[model samples]
Target: MAENPAYPVGLRLTGRKVVVLGGGQVAQRRLPALIAAGADILLVSPEATPSVEAMADAGEITWHRRPYAEGDLADAWYALIATGDTEANTRASAEAERHRVWCVRSDDADAATAWTPATGHSEGVTVAVLTTEARGRDPRHTAAIRDAVVEGLRDGTLVAPHHRTRTPGVALVGGGPGDPDLITVRGRRLLAEADVVIADRLGPRDLLAELPPHVEVIDAAKIPYGRFMAQEAINNALIEHAKQGKSVVRLKGGDPYVFGRGMEELNALAEAGIPCTVVPGISSSISVPGAAGIPVTHRGVAHEFTVVSGHVAPDDERSLVDWASLAKLTGTLVILMGVDKIGKIAETLVAHGKPADTPVALVQEGTTAAQRRVDATLATVGETVRTQEVKPPAVIVIGEVVGVGPRTSA
Candidate 1:
């Protein structure tokens, strides 16, 4: 800490003039925050990076297309002097000082009247960290600290319960495939804030352990043809928790809407007069195969990829998927929740004119430490799965694209 520390403040630069004397990387980085603050930015530089030029082209900032002039900072509320030239930057800094404009110098922080803090935003909160020059002015260290704070706040590890406004409602959050890190930032944040979390067996199960002890975590283990919580019971739990003025999060694996029956839960919440926020996750149909180094659609191989739920057999009367039509298409087929019925699924496709020798790959527990890929042909997939003991929550890719990329197996 310095004897005389710089006072930290938030600038409301909306509709205010902010002059920038550079178009290099530094200016390119700083301009976005200025634009986001609704600042009327004026950039003066003979040449700029392509990204900076694109911003000027998009009318986000005004480009002077010349060197900085003396009057550039005349009416500017703030200025950024980042022109690499020593003399030019010094001149712009002087001009800004004469006009009583606070200026940040990228090349020389000690000489600058103002310093930009390492900043991060989470939800509606803005986190800014500034270190005194006396502390050696380590931007990297400050940035690291900023990241730690932001992540803690986002994951709910650091919480100021009394300071936050708790909105009691239900959020249908897609936890994404099986990896804990695959969960969306919004979904993770809601989970961190949840008073009650009703989780599915499939999604990032590890995240449940991270929840605070006060959080009631219900295992809505809707396992296929097994002991599980009923849909109605899950809905009632969500409604009941929310009615008690507690925040509820219904966390499901992969995308909630993509065969996760998310709509049913959402509809139930709506009927109960409970507000619901739907946060979509990365669906396993595409991501799982990709994680196993298989592209669902590769150029000159597969132009289209179709995602179909294999929970029910293709020959089942209740099945909505047209396996006959799918077999006719010269594209990729991504099947989710079809491990047990894969033999029947493959037989139906083969019977529908799909070649028995077509390539097939099963990616199990994709994007997680337990992830593994098994390769086979449409004809051999059923036997291979049975012999290998392939389990539920695996994504089966059937197409030429499966053979396109380098095979990765556990």
Candidate 2:
């Protein structure tokens, strides 16, 4: 057991030389962080994972295709010994010690002078957990703590917030179903950094309360009926706010592109010559059904699934849905924003050759505490919707795939 304790400090390795003596699993795990820190990486190994090879091909790092040798860390600021060969790792660490460079041994941390802490990053804060227990420094234990802090920051529990240079741009972030935890890690980070948040009614509304006082929260579906506003006005609001040198977040439910008008916003911002980024969220069309114990596509049950907007009635001339064709697909049919038109939609599907007995599931406000799943057949779904008073934003799954999985928590 290595009884000697080590001091913890953040290394400023940006543009500094770092030597990595392996390109396998351990190297793959540690390389991205070093590359992200802008280190001048020199990778020594005979073979590497496809991802590391791709990185090398992209000129992100310099690859030395050979075994590790003494004096490898002569001019390196930091060194990592990750080879499978014990002798090679020992030699590399000894050379790092000789050259006054702290070496991290992947196979045996006790033999190395430095230990890599379990690390995570969120909202510009990097949480690193290190175990001081020399006899039993379980990396898993340290990583659990790191994950908790990072998750808390992500879900707005750990509110260590900051402003990052006031980037005057738009971030089209998909808020994911109704669950605050379902949002993507990058989306959550950008949400924390937003100066203004333009939110939709169907979006994860719970997260809005977590925003700081300085952040301007605009409701697109409130008293003003902002979602009904001319899209030009919406575009102008985004442009105007960004022009003021504030980071703007246009938060929408599920994927911004899945009938959320995200591309229009992207185009408007692009035409205005403003920088923008799109962080995708989990689409409710799939997640909601799953949350309700309905698999949109089950192996040996449903090979294909089609997602359609039910907001427009089938009789409407503007509606382009091929109800006749949709009726023909033996696979699953996922309808979003279709609760109001479910009766009409189901009538059309059944009339157009879809079986009246096809299993149907309507999941309302899925992935939330208020989530409710109602099971019915195509022939009875319309009646069930009326009886249950199921409203908009519910995911209607039509197919045998709905019953493929043992019913979740009803």
Candidate 3:
């Protein structure tokens, strides 16, 4: 009898039983996706890799810790035959056939009832590619095609040339340091769909050049502001553009909620009944220091790290930071936008009780082509900043953890 062709369908297997007859590398690779789909998996392998054992110990899956048997697929909605022993796989497949459950064979695709396709998602679209032709059965070939399509959709090339049905709303995107590649996949997709982009000075600027020419790009630095109502003017611009039925993207440097005044924009949008979406970007604080070979927190060297804004001097009346309390911390202290006031900040911390000789690393333009670092003690960082000419948008790490990574000093 000729075998029936395999059909592809997405299974909503939440809370359903799935029997897996392997405990090797292939099983490890497939388990995470099934777990993510909320499937109840039963593993019938005697010995497993450390990662699989860890998952079982963590209560992620039910591990039988033994070989497969006739009744293994009795209550399973689906079964997978992936063991090295051909007899074991044959037994499992027979049991699945008797139970009328779909079985997938990793060793022999021709003998399997189901085949897993290479899958990816772009925005609300889910892409699943399967090879039906005789020469297209290679999983590697299928995955390569899938990745190319996903990348095209991400970078905006696959999208339609005309965006006629664009949504009128606001998207606050974090550009993630200065490298264009560091931006999130979702963020890149949104940029392709944007009609208007209001970008900041410190955000990823390279991506703006790649956007379609029809897309309006506005530099936030060039936007005129009122004396004390600059934020208000910016908020008005977003609302005005959205009301005109244009999708607006307010692209900032790092995470919008973290000192980016994202909450203020959200509140303003809510007040005016405008729709808004926020996409988070990797902050330069941790990533920049890391690029400069400095760990903010090391296992035994330091246990915690705090990221603070140093735009205001410690003695200034408008400064809300409790500099006195910061000096008492025994962990890492990361200061952003404090290059100009490094001298005052260092003096304040030293006076309040922090060690004068604590290691301080200033990572400038981190994670970018022009990234550079300068090292000094808390007592001498202000002078070192002057001598080395460390520029703005730098991350300063003040703690013992700075010595944990290689090249702590520039």
Residue 142's lDDT in candidate 3: 90
Model 3 alpha-carbon drift over 4 Å, by segment: 1-116, 151-166, 226-228
Task: Using lDDT, rank the candidates from best to worst.
Answer: 1, 2, 3
**Superposing every Cα of model 3 onto the true structure, what RMSD results?**
5.0
Writing each residue's lDDT as its tens digit, candidate 1 over 112-214 gives: 8899999998888999999966347888999999999999888666764645567789999999998889898888888888889989989799999988899
Model 1 weakest lDDT span, ten residues long: 221-230
Give the better candidate number (1 or 2) by lDDT: 1
Which pairs clash in model 2?
none
Q: Report the C-alpha lDDT of model 2 over 1-410, residue by residue, as the tens digit.
A: 54656789999999999999889988888999999999999999999999889989999999999998777788899998999999988888888888889889888877778889899986567888888754577777788899998887876566654544765899999999989989987788788878899888888988888888988998865424355565667778889899999889999999999999999999989999999999899999999988888888778999999999998999999899999999999999999989999989999999999999998899988999998889898899989999998877789999998878887756
Find the candidate with the highest lDDT and give its number: 1
Please identify which of the two predictions, 1 or 3, would achieve the higher lDDT against the true structure. 1
Arranged by TM-score with the best first, the candidates are 1, 2, 3
lDDT of every model, 2 decimals: 0.89, 0.88, 0.86
Model 2 CA lDDT for position 200: 86
Candidate 2 overall lDDT versus native: 0.88
